[model samples]
Target: MAENKSTSARAASAASSKTEADIQAQIDQLRGDIANLTKLIGDLGSEKASQARARAEKLRDDATKAGQEAYDRARDEALSMEEDLEDRIRMKPLQSILIAAGVGFLAALFTRR
Candidate 1:
């Protein structure tokens, strides 16, 4: 009976040691997997940031080009209006001068009071 008790104790100790070793190996494998996943996440974040910066730069360039086009269109319209006014003044110089003189006379009369 004493010999049987001793054999059972030895078996239990061996089994406990084997289980402990297996658990340690699993913990080490999980740590390695965690490290790899962290690195992959960081790389993806950097790639996404680079893509966002490129998109922002493209948008800024597009806005600048649109603003320049709008400025050119407005300048062309203003030039057309100026040329049209000049043509009308050349065709009726006396009328333009008379209107200017009338406005000036009215301004002067109002200020004299």
Candidate 2:
């Protein structure tokens, strides 16, 4: 009976140690999983920020291209109008002078108020 009691005590101690080891392993695994999940979430956020930055850069490029195109078209139209005005002025200098004076007078009149 004494031998049996010693054997039983050893068995219980072994079982307790194993249980403690298993619980520690579970805690360590949970910590590792949490670390991995945190890293994955951070990586996902960085990827999204990169994608958004790329989109914003593309939009800026598009806007710059559109602005240049509009500027070019407006410049061409202005040049054409200037050529036409020059031709008309050469054909009738006196009439052009009279028109200019009339415009100046009107501008002065509006400014006086």
Candidate 3:
């Protein structure tokens, strides 16, 4: 009977040690997994930041190009209007001078207030 009790106790102790070792190994594995998760999150953040920067740069470039095109179009239209005005003035110098004088008189009248 004493031998039986001793053997049972030995068996229980062996099982307990195995359980503790298993728990320790699981804790180590969890730590490693946490570290890997943290690294993955950081890498993802970096990748997203890079993508955002690239997108912003592309948007900025697109806006700049659109602005330049609009400016060019406006300048071309202004030049066309200037040439038309000049041609009209050359065709009717007296009329052009009379229109300019009338516009200046109206402007002076409005500005007097």
Candidate 4:
């Protein structure tokens, strides 16, 4: 009877030790998994942030290009109109002088305080 009890006690101790070891192994695995997941999340966040920056830079460049194009068009139109005005004035010098004087007089009158 005493030997039976001793054998049962030994069996229980062995099972307890195995359970503790298994639980420790599971805890270690969980810690490793948590660390890996944390790293993955950080990497994903950095990649997304980099993508956003690239998109923003592209948008800024596009806007700058569009603004430059508009400026060029406006400059071209202004130069063409100036040439046309010069030709008209050259063809009718006296009329152009009179019209300019009249516009200046009217502007002076309008700006009077």
Best by TM-score: 4
Cα error, candidate 1, residue 71 (Å): 0.6
Candidates 1 and 4 compared by TM-score, better number: 4
Work out the TM-score per prediction. 0.73, 0.88, 0.82, 0.93
Deviation of model 3 at 84, angstroms = 1.9
Clashes of each: 0, 0, 0, 0
lDDT by candidate, in order shown: 0.99, 1.00, 1.00, 0.99
Once superposed on the true structure, which residue ranges of model 3 sit more than 4 Å away at CA?
none
lDDT at 86, model 4: 97
Clashing pairs in 2: none
For candidate 4, give the lDDT of residue 62.
Answer: 100
Off by over 4 Å in 2: none
Q: Compose the digit string of candidate 4's lDDT tens values, residues 16-82.
A: 9999999999999999999999999999999999999999999999999999999999999999999
lDDT of 2 by residue, 7-110 (tens): 99999999999999999999999999999999999999999999999999999999999999999999999999999999999999999999999999999999
Name every residue pair that clashes in candidate 3.
none
Cα miss at 41, model 2 (Å)? 1.0
Model 2 score (lDDT):
1.00
> Looking at candidate 1, what is the lDDT of residue 11?
99
How many collisions between residues are there in candidate 2? 0
- By summed lDDT, the worst window of 10 consecutive residues in model 1 runs over 92-101
- Residue-level lDDT of model 1, residues 6-79, one tens digit each, is 99999999999999999999999999999999999999999999999999999999999999999999999999
